[model samples]
Target: MGKKKHEPPPPTGGLDQNGLEKRLCNCICLCQLVSILSGVALLYLSVIVVSPSKQTLDAEFESTPVVCTTLENMRNSTNCSVLSCGEWCISKGGSTCAIIHAKVRREGSAVSFRDCDPVRATFCSAQEYNQTQQFICSEGEDKTGQCDALDRFMDCKPIKNKADDIKTEMTSLCRNITAIRDCRGTKPDGTQEKEIHVCTRYTCNALNGIYECSTGNCKKLENPTCVDRCSNLDMGNMAVVTPDLFHWGRCRSAFSNGTRIWTDQQKPLSMYCTRIRNVSATEMEAEDCLNGTLMDAPSFRQITNYKQMLGVLERNEEPLFEDQSFLPSEKTVEIFNRTKVMINVLGCVNTLRKECTTWLAHKGRDGSEGMHPAVYPCFITPHATNYVITDYDRQATVSQLVMASAVPSCLLLFSCFCLCLCGKTVGVNEFGLFFCKPCHKQDGDGGKEPAKLRAP
Candidate 1:
């Protein structure tokens, strides 16, 4: 053979070259898409970490609230599929009526299913009534409770039945009759008069300090009790706050005279009892309470001012008022349970240091008019935070949030590594993940290995 010619292997086979390039390009394109998506995810996560407190929503919303039994029963009674706005009036006829309803969950809220409760229905403002249904929002005081004959008190009055016994009377402030619980009355002669004891909100042990409800079963306990400011000239009992007499009520530092610190420059908050109950006749006590049995408030006789009262009321514990945090089963709205109440994540309450006051917490805070909702008849009921988030429950939500984002975070990291063989970058745009932006050119020397690839 005259110099056998080998023609440079025929430029590597066109089919093989084309197929390999196509496969590589497809892979690179997929990686680019994945990288872009991963980068967005990372950025989103970063933004959340540095963003406003997640508690911001919590500030205005009760995260996961349950319906009070009285209201829940109302919900069960509704036979209609589509609902209407409600006008719940505890005592109607005029502005004097105590409208009992809450904001319902909006048509599209995270927990809109809660709107199933009747208290929220028929209670929304005119602006956002359900569009599909014929909306009806009454303009003035609601009269729905009229048929029910709710005992709505326009003002508190003295008990005329007691026959000149001015010490006790009928008042919107309280309902059930109460005996002067535990205290020694002081006469003008400066001598002790009668020593008596009555139902107190807390069961206490003197040495150990105050603890739980004095009433073994707060549900059955129906007497309304509280610690009001006293005056030296006043004839009210000079009794120390005993275990049974735990402090409960809205002792807001601003509106209230905390620890009486206003008079003197003290670092703490305090209040003064200017007007309080004057003693009468009735109940008496029979106990030494030596073994922490009769625990008194810290510095009872010398109670000057509340040390710090504002933040304390906001705690998730059962509300301080007998009228607050009571289960629907607790039939009675204690004398102190006012028409106005604080609706919060804790529950519908007569007193709340935080948030504004409103009636008819028929809806959630995010509902047409939002609030921590509750419902009750003016009868006896169990006292507790049936609707408030327990400490254990409040704690459980945070971990779920962290665990929920774990999968996405790992997926993002995994995507970064996979793209490495082609091309990828991390920490781009502070949190951006960039993938291979590759371009291929037809080789002048023909396809040898492949286009020059970049490391991820």
Candidate 2:
């Protein structure tokens, strides 16, 4: 018999070549369709995942009350009075009432009593009194026995109301001294002294050639020369005076160096006794004093304004909602007209310093617009578009879009590879691609061989 033709064992699974090819083509078509559909679905899902929706939200804002309280209550108050006074005293080259008040408060009983407190005649001496009497009698128009008698009488009669008498006598004496002088013939510094009479009031100290009594009473001198032995004029402490005072105010320095410098040349030194309006428990509002005019505490309305930017929306105004289908025509107008909104004042400084201000408002869920107590740096206007622009578009970044597209692209490439191998002599059945090498029986030759490919 003719050797049997070695036709490739009947196409696996009892399927004819035509039948197997048909089944493989059908599988490739199904896989290609699945890949295309999956890719399209993935692309659609990616767009939905990254695209940001645009909507106009009706934003309503309110503000908390600006409760006035001391810095001690605010938990930031400091004893800067010492530095404040020392700087002022140094600036004018003299001491002031504010300085004396500060000294007395800080140093307690250690501070020498001026004639302001004559009950404590700690520095008064008979020798000083005799010299004062002699100088007064000599300077008067009547240098006769009458002036000496008057001086004697004043010295003896001052016990009844010592404080009253001292104030009266000191005021008279200070007014008479056209120029400052050393009470003793020679200067206290042991130098030859000329014709100036030392004046004593609350305390004994040499006065400047030109001096004026500060407003309250003669108890404190406005512009007296820095001659008191007890005056602790420390340059180090005074050097930090401006920063300390600014710190007391809690002001953010507009200077490039982030500090406020105090110099004689700078107008309106930072140590001036300025007032803040709309002061709250945590915040202090600074105000400018014009022509030395003292400003009164801010009114409630002004305080409210300082804390918030209030506005009234007119009826029929453009609706905050981009899609108003859910809102009634009349309701929209009513809500718009009734709703009130306010933005917080960024800086605590007065209205004159607008450059430091921010347009951002503190927004809260409830109507009560309370905020945590913290200082915020000024916002960059150019970068802060979300704050000012009510209606703006937001979109996903380029990187997100790329990632969304890449995942589906990889899936499509994998599916295409499977499609290309569909009709080969490999396992491709209704259950899908299966490896047959593990399940196949080994031939007598000891070589592992694949089982016949199954046809769907």
**CA RMSD of all predictions:** 23.7, 28.7
What is the C-alpha lDDT profile of model 1 across 12-52, one tens digit per residue? Answer: 22333345445655666676777777667656654442121
lDDT of each: 0.25, 0.26
Q: Which segments of candidate 1 are over 4 A away from where they belong?
A: 1-20, 45-399, 424-456
Model 2 bad stretches (over 4 Å): 1-9, 13-41, 50-254, 257-396, 424-456
Instruction: Judge candidate 2 at residue 51 and give its lDDT.
Output: 34
Error of 1 at 148 (Å): 23
lDDT at 96 for candidate 1?
A: 21
